[model samples]
Target: MSTIVFAFSIFCGWLIFDVVKHRKLTLESLVSSLVIAVVAGVFWWILDLFF
Candidate 1:
């Protein structure tokens, strides 16, 4: 539950960062940010499982 929320927050936060940096949103930016967020979420999940 919290992990899911955190993943979404990461996505949103990354998207906002890209938007601010580029001054626009595009498919590339969206996908890149989403990929990064997913990777972070997966890493966090694995860590949670271990510890």
Candidate 2:
């Protein structure tokens, strides 16, 4: 369940990031999406461990 949620979050995050960035494939958007995803993953992991 967590895995599925995390993957969905990443996909959603990427979509939002892509829109905000105004580019489908660029270094900045890629980095921003990755960073956001990673942060979200870590946050999810912490939540899973705690709750």
Candidate 3:
């Protein structure tokens, strides 16, 4: 749970950075960030489970 939360926070940070750098927040960016976050969380979870 904590790991998941941490992943989410990191995602939020990335999203914010993208928005700031681009000077506009778009739906595509939001969706991509969500997708990336999910993939990263899954990868981390699997790694933690195995090692």
Write the residue-wise lDDT of candidate 1 on 1-51 in tens digits. 757777899999999999999999999999998998888889888888899
Model 1 segments more than 4 A misplaced: none
lDDT of 3 by residue, 1-51 (tens): 966996798689879988998999999889888888888888888888898
**Cα error, candidate 3, residue 14 (Å):** 1.8
Report RMSD (Å) for each prediction in the order shown. 0.8, 2.7, 1.2
lDDT of each: 0.90, 0.75, 0.86
Give lDDT tens digits, candidate 2, residues 4-32: 57956896779676976685567777677
- Regions of candidate 2 where Cα sits further than 4 Å from its true position: 1-12, 15-23
Best by lDDT: 1
Question: TM-score for all predictions?
Answer: 0.90, 0.65, 0.83
Question: lDDT: which is higher, 2 or 3?
Answer: 3
Instruction: Measure candidate 3: CA RMSD.
Output: 1.2
> Local error of candidate 3 at 22, Å?
0.9
